[model samples]
Target: MTSAPKPISAIDLFCGAGGLSLGLKQAGIEVAAGFDFDESCRFPYEANIGARFVHADIAEVTAEHLEEIWDGAETRLLAGCAPCQPFSSHRRGADTSEESNWSLLEHFGRLVNETKPEFVTMENVVRLMRMPVFEQFVQGLEELGYTVDYRTVNGPLFGLAQTRRRLILVASRQGEINVPKGLGNGPATTVRDIISGLPVLENGQSDPTDPLHRARSLSPLNLKRMRASKPGGTWRDWPEALLAACHRKPSGQSFQSFYSRMEWDRPAPTITTQAYNFGTGRFGHPDQDRSLTLREAAMLQGFPVDYQFVPTGSKPTLSKVGKLIGNAVPPAFGRAVGQTFIRALAQSIEQGEPT
Candidate 1:
């Protein structure tokens, strides 16, 4: 009889909605715990991930906590993707202010230094490279004797239908860890592929039954504005009477994607926290009257069709659910990173090298 392979374990920090943990579980890794500061996230993280959620600041997490959870595991991984809004290009690099929110990455480094986990991984917007702090992070890992590899990746090329690009980093004390290779030149998945079959609704409609599948309310003026907008159509296509005051302004003239409809054949625009508003971004459905639904946004973020996010009585507003989906790392993207780590671990075991 053959023996089973050794088990792998990981602890996830900033584990919003448990996207990364779900992916790690898909890759056969046991999640030790999910750590986050948001008490609101605790129920969802624990319910979906089947792991403990530590609803405290990461700064309060001690080495003993990590050791206690990782006990009896052959390999330990410390994984996190610090909040990326501070480094996002959409915000035009204004996230450089020394605000408390900007220090999550530094906190991640502290956790690594204190616990000395065998493996470390992180994912964020590619714009993070523009900051000097990223270099400091790399140097800190190197100082701790870790072989680190990182690169920018396009999510659509790796099974996600959204045009999401991210910076992923993996480091190991056992040997070198490389970024997942892109599956070159395949056809991009489109909006229709992700949400073609769901029941349709109007601009301000809900399923009446499936509360989680509801759309945000639209104002009377906005409803007329959306009706005039067709798939892939811009504000230029809207009737003059329905145009918003900003649309007529010289400063707002350049923003074309607003109040625009999505193309059925094209990958979706980046899902944002306000994706249900036709005027917010390119969130309108290709052939439908309304903006993208909450379920559609979740699907584009690579959540499974049945993945439960919100609970009973709590209405799934576009802004709230969009924030959850937009903030999450796609599970497929995490699986790709996990596979890379698996290969690196195997190589280290074979060659007697440090990971």
Candidate 2:
């Protein structure tokens, strides 16, 4: 009889919609539990990922709680992608005095230091490197005797169709660490490459059989607004009468680019939580008459066609599903990081480092 493969186990922190957990599972690791404060995530995280979802604030989770959950597992992997909203490039020129996201990484460090997992991995926006907190985070890992490797990587280089970039950091208690090479940027994946084959829907239409494919309802004024919009066109193309009052001024002309349509032959713009706002970003479909639906947005995020993040009976609203998709680390990127973490650990084990 053939022997079974060795089990790889992990615990995911700040697990939003279980994207990283799902990717790790794809690589043969079993996620024991996911910790997050979003109660809205509980249904999707549990239903789709099949991992125990703890809806507690991370600042309140104790080391004892983690130890009890590990249950003497030989090799424990701790993974997290801290909230990056406060440290994003968009927030650079603004005052973020009220943002609490910066401190979460420190909390992550505290938990890892106390629990002493054999391996660790983290992902975030590239702009985070500019923060003094990030520097201290790297120094803290070295103090704990971890061999760390951190770098920013583009998602499309790893076979993801989107042009999203993220900072990935992997550290091992055992030995040296390095990120894996990119699979190479061969072809630029276009919007058609991802969602082209899916069933087509008109504005405010829904696939009766697939709730997840439903498009958000449009207001009558907005319906008339989009009809005047063209793929790759801006509000400049709209009739003068339909333009927003502010957009009618010279100062507002600069912001006209915000409400634009996506080009058909090019890669879609970065999908954000408010991507359904046709005027908020390059969210309008290339050749279609509607903004990118929740299903299309999820697909562009590298989720498999049949991947289930929302429940069957749940209404797939733009705001709700957008938060779920937007907050998720693209599974393709997650898998790349997971493989690198595993390799770094294996190298450390062979060379006999700290763990």
Candidate 3:
């Protein structure tokens, strides 16, 4: 009699609040364990993902440890979305290659070379594509006899309610695999589609039932600015006096997306770590005179409405939560990733066999 195939499992590196883990679970993949340096992620990852979460710096993680955590799953996946600040477009023109923290990508590459998991995946800011490190990672995988492919995908194309563009890479030692291209279907998801139903809140008001729905307080001057700000409109729409000194300068003209409002019919702008701050990007509400609520930011990032990022009663600090949400890979995109891997695995002739 033929033996049953061993189930596929994944070890998530830099798994923030378990977004990728949750999506993998949603796609029927077993998330064996998650690793990150943040202790705050333990509860949410374990609670929601029902998987083991190890709070440790990726720099300290070893391939042996990751394999041990794999627990003998015949088909294993190693996935990571290393912190991207060093490679972010915002820091362009300044060389960040020598920073010790940027070595996190090197660590990820080392683990892949050592562990040689059946599947490997990575996600990061699109700007990473231009970096030599990205070329090294892709070439290293190919040298290991793995078929590798990568692409830049827009969030809305993959069911996200925002327009985040990211670079996604997938490698398989078993067989040829491809990245999932979001089909340009009918209408893309929009802000109203995601957050229109939440209970309304004024600036500085919190929902009694769900504190995550609270909006950040806006100053009087900014409040008037928001009121005058049209959805998808720029800061130039404001009265000349309301414009910041920077806005008066020609250099600031290109920064029009800041302090604007999201259109109800379109996907939200990329959710940044400061998404709750009105002055950052087009985070203001479509009709309300305030910036996005915490929950709204999560929704735009493709997290569920009730997704838990903190302990039941522990306070959810806005900046921390924003960072967590902003740094997360959208669950919708994660689901697509999980689905694509599963599809490729099914056709993989290796089938966890000794090659």
Error of 3 at 115 (Å): 0.9
Question: Each candidate's TM vs. the true structure?
Answer: 0.91, 0.88, 0.93
Local accuracy of candidate 1 as per-residue lDDT tens digits, 1-355: 2234465789998898888988888877789899877666676788789999987676667788888888867888999888864332234244456343447787789889998888899998888877877888899999999999999988778878888888999999987778887677888888888888788887678877666566667788877777888787798887889888898889998999998889988888887777767778998888767777778888888888777777866776556567777788889887887777777677667676333
Which prediction has more favorable lDDT, 2 or 3?
3
Question: Which is superior by TM-score, 2 or 3?
Answer: 3
- Sort by TM-score, best first: what order? 3, 1, 2
- lDDT of candidate 1 at residue 8, scale 0 to 100: 70
| Cα shift from native, residue 176, model 2 (Å) | 2.2
The runs of at least 3 residues in candidate 1 whose Cα sits more than 4 Å from the true structure, single-residue gaps closed, are: 1-4, 85-101, 353-355
Q: What is the alpha-carbon lDDT of model 2 when measured against the actual structure?
A: 0.78
Task: Residues 79-153, candidate 2: write the lDDT tens digits.
Answer: 988887533223335455534457778888899889888788898888888887889888988889988888988
Q: Candidate 3: where are CA atoms >4 Å away?
A: 1-5, 86-101, 349-355
lDDT of 3 at 157: 89
Top of the candidates by lDDT = 3
RMSD to the native, candidate 2?
4.4
Could you give me the TM-score of model 3 versus the true structure? 0.93
For model 3, how does the per-residue alpha-carbon lDDT over 254-290 read when each residue is reduced to its tens digit?
Answer: 9989999999999999998889998989999999878
* lDDT accuracy of residue 271 in candidate 1: 78
Which has the better lDDT: candidate 1, or candidate 3?
A: 3
